[model samples]
Target: MDQKTNTVASILFMVTGMATVGVIDNFITYIAVEVSLWQFHFLRSMIAVPAIVGFGLLAGWTLRPLRLWPVLGRNMFLSGAMFVYFGCLGFFPISAVAAGLFTAPVLVMFIDAVWSRRRIGPIRLATACLGFLGTLLVLKPDVGGLGWANLIPVSAGLMYAFGNVATRKWCEGESAVALLWSYMFLMLIFGALGVIYLHVFPGDPSSYLTRGWVWPSASVWMWIAIQAVFSLIGIGFIMKAYLIGEVTYVSIFEYSMLIFASATAWMLFGDRLGALGFVGIGVIIVTGIVIAVRSNAADN
Candidate 1:
């Protein structure tokens, strides 16, 4: 594919990934608030692993160079981020968590500049600051309005953003197949540990293995299985974006997930944002456009 074709393809991949991930994440949020993070993580990963792996093999994915360490590092960070994200979901409004997570692109830019020594130009830096201001407004930082739980999602955003940066800078040359599968594998391990910590180590193991174990409702299982099936494609698209675009640019696509989530929330759950929320959404949209436009110019 030519460069322009590749960029568009990557962006589409990213958008679709985020759109589908909105489904997965909201469903998980729906469930996790009622159950422990351990419960959902185990059930989701138990299903996600086999499904992602089988599909990868069927699609003729190969693991050339086998870079397991970087995969481990990046995905461990992601796993921790997810723990915090879901924990926050259990405590706060879904839109609130989504707003916090949108700070990731700004965080990614700053982290990349600091770690990679990339020069932060005036435009990029200004956009980052503006985006962060929007986040603070949504969060009502001046009021200290959001509780400690809000920190969970924000922390997840930071870690997830940093992981994307690492993916772009250090692991771009790796096989997309390897990166996706390896990250899934890593999540499986982390999820397994979550299960073990909660279930196996229970002073009364029976309570966990039998009593409190999350029995995924039929609908929840369907959601997870569908996610397991589709997220491989989602992750592949994201990996391609990481390879071909700047991390800041591709990461901004995450805000697109927020857009999808907001619409889904309103349609499915009767959720609506207030004035500040709308402002935050507008900032997210505007900054995302700026990032895309500037990145396209640089690409040319």
Candidate 2:
């Protein structure tokens, strides 16, 4: 019974974290073009690093793992996934990129099945397919605009799938706060290196792809600060969720992110979806319900 309760709570935490992540994306979208991606990561990590470290220290938690390389490897997969996914935003619509990234859940399911050599029951398989279909409908990827570049986000999904599974399989004993700090620290290092590269070889600031290292305005700093706070709270919950729940089951809940992002976009940008989009939203909700119900059954 306790395990069941924890599973339910973890699912809630994961869903809430994903929703908060949606908000973070919205905040970043406002100033994304103004600041280079590396600068954004570096500046945000400046705030996140201290905050997370302080919290871990205050709580008297272990801030480092027994084995560093595996943890670093896991974080690298996720960080690389995020960077690649964001880079693809320049080539594709945010929705399409997100749809590709959402494929992570399916990959998670597949990887788990293959690694364990266990058969995925029919219900899980059906729901995964339904969820992907719903995501495709919601994203409405542009067939004409699609090209070889579309592979980037799919690769990100694969990386993310590996990272999520690694969190559960390899780093189960580690503190979520510690793992969080490591991730931020890695991003900080990479961000710093990227800024140095921009300094050495500058490019057109106006060009979206080649641009790097712009001096952020006061408002941009404020936005990055807000995003950092969100990352702390949001990522903490997600880390806890993966630590507590089954990876294959937990991953399916991430589809709710699209729903959350759509709602945020509607309120913040006054962006409304058409009828097909609404239908897609309904399908996603159904997908969530199916997964939640099945997860409960499995838990019992």
Candidate 3:
């Protein structure tokens, strides 16, 4: 396909993937009331890993990683980020959690600048500042009752940034399918650990983060299956989008997840955001566009 055609296709894939994720993720809150985070991850991965393998085999895609250690390291960070991101969903609005998670691109820029010993130009630095301000506005941390939980989503963003760096530095040339397999496998492992730890030292049954295994109701099982299926579909499209399109151009479309998630949350759950929150989301989206454009230019 021509470059323009490829870009259009990529944008479609990216938007579809983001919308899928945005919708499925809001359902996490529904299940969170009934199951522990660990149990949820464990069960979701249980379903996802086998399904991924089956699909990989049928499609004749190699699931083995070219570099095992790097893939493992990348999965560790990415899985950890999801762990935190999902955990936050049990407590915060999807819009807030998603806005924080989308900070990954900005964090990636800062990490790359420091690790490469490159000076940040004025525009990039200003963009970073705006991004930070946006995060604060979205999170709206209460100083009087400030606690670590308020910053959990940003921590997820940090881990996601590291995972992105690892992907570029070490997992280059690896098959996207292989990376996806390894990531799901690691999530399975992490979920098992969380389940075991909680079993040994259980906490409040009602607490999603602390609660251990519970017999899932039919509804819980259904939602989890839905989560697994939609997540695979979303991830597959996102991987394809990156493979076919310019990274800078494709990455910008990911910001669309913010809009999808926020809108879906409002429609489905009556989750509403104030004017300042919407403004904050806008700022973050604008910052992400600036970063993508500037990064592309710098590469040229």
Candidate 4:
């Protein structure tokens, strides 16, 4: 009973962490409207670098892990995943982007199954199909309506799943702070590449995607600071949750981020999905909950 309680609590913590990240990302979208994409990444990395180091020291964690190359490679995948995710925000609704990204859990399941050469159970396969259907409803991609850019967030979700698998399979025993710092270092490197690209070949100034680096205004600094703080708290809880709970069960709760993002998008940006979209979101959550419950039962 106590184990069950702890599992439930950990799942809640994971959901809360994802919700916090979703809300923070909405604020990031607002900030991105006025700042360059890479600039935001660069500045957030700057703040997170010191903040993560301080966190490691305060928590008395070993900042150095025994395995270096594997950890770096895993984080590079994560950084690329997030880079595409944030870049999509420049061109798409946060809710839509989030809905697409939440497919990571399904991808995780599929990847694990393939890697193990195990047959996917009937119920799990059905739920995965249903989830994909829900994503289509959210997208509502008609002929020539949704462009190739829509694929970006979907690809990000796949990369994120791969990164998560690498974390669990190869990077165990490493401190969460160490994992986080590696991720931030890659973010800084990616940001520098973005800076160089923009400077050498600029494009439309009106679009955030192609805009060159600019001096951070006071407002940008405030938003970047907010992102750094909330991200630290949220990612810490999330990493702990992943460490403590069954990955399949815990990952289902990550869909809650879409719920939070949808509300935040509506409240802050006057963005709301249509009736079909809401229904699709409902389908995804209901199916995810069912899968999570079944997964937990099997574990027991």
Which candidate gets the maximum lDDT versus the true structure? 2
Q: Give me the displacement of residue 76 in model 2, in angstroms.
A: 0.8
- Model 4, residue 184: distance off in Å is 1.4
Off by over 4 Å in 1: 1-6, 33-35, 134-144, 203-212, 296-300
Clashing pairs in 1: none
Worst 10 residues of 2 by lDDT: 140-149
lDDT of 4 by residue, 1-300 (tens): 465675787687888898889788887666777778888888888899888888789988888866999888788778888888888888776756765677798888788678667777877778777876775565444413455766778889988888877777678777777787777878988888888899999866777878888877798789899998898778767776665665655766676677677777778787766787688788878877777667645432
Per-candidate TM vs. native?
A: 0.84, 0.93, 0.84, 0.87
Tell me the tens digit of each residue's lDDT in model 3 across 1-300: 886677778778878998899778988977998999999999999999999999999999989998889789888998999999999899887756765687776676667667778776777678777876765565444322546665788799889877766766677678778888778888888999999999999898889999978999999999999999899888768766766765534655666676677778778877666687688778878876676556535532
Instruction: For model 1, state the Cα shift of residue 117 in Å.
Output: 1.2
Model 4 CA deviation exceeding 4 Å by range: 1-10, 132-144, 200-204, 296-300
- Write one digit per residue (lDDT tens) for candidate 1, span 21-92: 776566655464334556666666677667656776788877643566776777777677766776666656
Query: What lDDT, from 0 to 1, does candidate 2 have?
Result: 0.82
The number of residue pairs in model 2 that clash at the backbone is 0
Q: What is the lDDT for 212 in model 3?
A: 77
Work out how many backbone clashes candidate 3 has: 0
Q: What TM-score quantifies how close candidate 2 is to the native fold?
A: 0.93
RMSD of 3: 3.3
List model 2 lDDT by residue over 121-237, tens digit each: 888898888888888777765434766777778899999999999998889878888889999899899888888888789877875445687778899888889988998888888
